[model samples]
Target: MMQAMTAAVAAMAFAISGQTAPGTTTRPVLSKAEAEPFTPETYLRYSGLYSAPVADPWRPKPIATGRPDYLVGGHGFASVQQAVNAAFRDGGAARRWIGVLPGTYTGTVFIPAGTPPLTIFGLGRPAEVRLEFTIDATVTPAVWAEQVNAAGRYAEGDPAWPMFRSCATKTSATAGLCATVVWAQSTDLQLKGLTITNTLLDTVDRGTHQALALRTDADRTQLENMRLISRQDTFLANADDVTRIARVSVRDTYLEGDTDFVFGRAAAVFTGTHFHLVSSRKAGGGVIFAPNTAPNYPYGFLVTHSRITADAAYQTAPTGYLGRAWDQGASATGYLPGSTPNGQLVIRDSLIGAGFNTVTPWASAATTARPFTARIDEGRDLNDVDHNRLWEHANRLTAAPAPAAGTTTSPGTRR
Candidate 1:
């Protein structure tokens, strides 16, 4: 059944890719009233097995000492990495709860795969516990070329060498550091009540700068009541590879970014979340999401019962786009097998602030065409009709009011 479905999806993707020609046959656009209603069940159904499966509550057995398996700061371990190392030494069957005291931590944290069931929770409020780093994607190609040649991470004539050179030639941030601040490659991981941030100031002038705070590539991962702070590529919902679909959920969390921040190809669901748009150098305006949903994956990214706001600095430029279809075949980054450029996003029952232009909130990152016009670039265009897989139902946004000066955010007009 799965193989048949995959074949059908591939056929649909091919059809959509060929539909961008002038005077060609295309799918008819659906009017607002004619569109299907966006609901939680719709998202879950598309998510398929990638959504969190029903499991019994996780209750780790207590040790005789009655203490946490590891503790960070507050006189325990001096660093988060230290605690993680201790957890590794004790093996997977030991105590599973790792407690973090209220404090600001500045460093990178890695949780490797096949570790064990773990729950890392913070004792204080979100503002109290912060794991942060500063690395911007501003290194020039010349500098990158010299540095990589000296380090010998890549050699000429290799299949991946050209891809590396291409990325180096582009203005790239520290892709390694930008993409791996808090990488969780292990399954059954849970992080709650803390803030993970990348304290790098990114602007369009910086050139392809991508500093990410957290990357969740594990299965059945859950994050609750946390704040993800960054300018670009803030929170990436990803998977280990293309064969298996990973599921991640962020509930009652805060995510802020400028461009393609909340992105990736994983089956991710954001419920009761707040999305903030910081001032970006992209004068065309920043995009909130760039979902590269695989053709076979029905659910890409779901933003439901959430609020999206923008700072006053975004008033002059065009309003932000709710999301842009990030088709994979448009660039070298999307050149992997089982990759499809078609994007699937659902925005439903959310209060959208005036920061988004109501008439055309959906856009395409692969092309320069306006919203609702499908124009794939570099002869890889797919389904240019904006409303094809991207749907909006019962979303309410008020008319734009005059911008106010200060740090205050204007409330959205909720009907």
Candidate 2:
């Protein structure tokens, strides 16, 4: 009996001290879920695995040049963009990774056609290396703004007679049309650990394309742990067509712009991200997720697990919306008058900070109880082809419960 009791106690001691469970031994098993402290590598690993899955069908291998010479001048490529071009153009190499060492390169990057999926991993997320540039529509390859035709299509023949000559380049409060870098057709372009910025924020003259640090016609891209800073139109997503679909995921990233800085018609998802609203301008143009869908697709925009801030400096009674359905040439397309009820926007499990216009909608007149033509069964909220429209407050925005408290975020929003 004594031997039996002694053996049982020994077994219990072994079970407790041998560390089958957590907190039992001096050195516990390091969970793959935990982040590494005080190390850039930890950020790299955390961002790599959790930020967002490569939205591409198949993630191409990382391109490694055997040596670091692909980096021009032994630091960054002759251009940050040239390195990107090399990675995607070369079909022979498997693991394609443009390892940008630490530095700031100034120039506009163009991701032309025939580029493949790319992953540009830097030393740390948006820290070790950076790309910054500025371009203006005033001095663009010659910009032209056209109106929609009778058939509700983009009319391309005429240009807006230059109203204001020479809109000087300066970071201002109003939104403009310039872009620092732009991409097209490319998918799964990963911007990891880099700071992309534009210094042109001054909107004194107005009616100019406020330069953007990053703009893309690219589809299905992911930005992780990157910082995007600009006053207006900081990030622009232009599409070749509204009907064709493009998906974007911005995870664990930071975006700070002055007025309506984030606007695009692309279907996008923002998760665990931060939005910075600046204070310089009285124009209350706020952040917006324009579901530029073709009034046909199901999902337009998805925002989950993110935070918004109207900069403390913005004291002039900021005048815009948390978001609004954009009117892309509504004055031209009678379609603009019919745009309100067609938007599909979802905001879940996210925190909406102030600088948001809570009283009135920032949506265009196209969204205010406009006439519906081919009206479907909308129950009662939409009844007439003339008077019924989408209710703006229909979705007041709410967050659903997560199972493990913080393991995963809500799904992407559809516009």
lDDT of each: 0.61, 0.46
- Could you give candidate 2's per-residue lDDT for residues 127-193 as a string of tens digits? 5466765555444332311110112122122111111121122344322443454434455576666
The residue pairs found clashing in candidate 1 are: 137-172, 137-173, 327-341, 328-341, 374-384, 376-381
Candidate No. with top TM-score: 1
Candidate 1 structure lDDT: 0.61
Give Cα distance to truth, residue 296, candidate 2, Å. Answer: 1.5
lDDT of 1 at 93: 56
The reply for model 1, stretches above 4 Å from the true place, is: 1-67, 93-95, 138-178, 202-206, 280-284, 332-339, 366-388, 401-407, 410-415
**Candidate 1, run of 10 with poorest lDDT:** 15-24
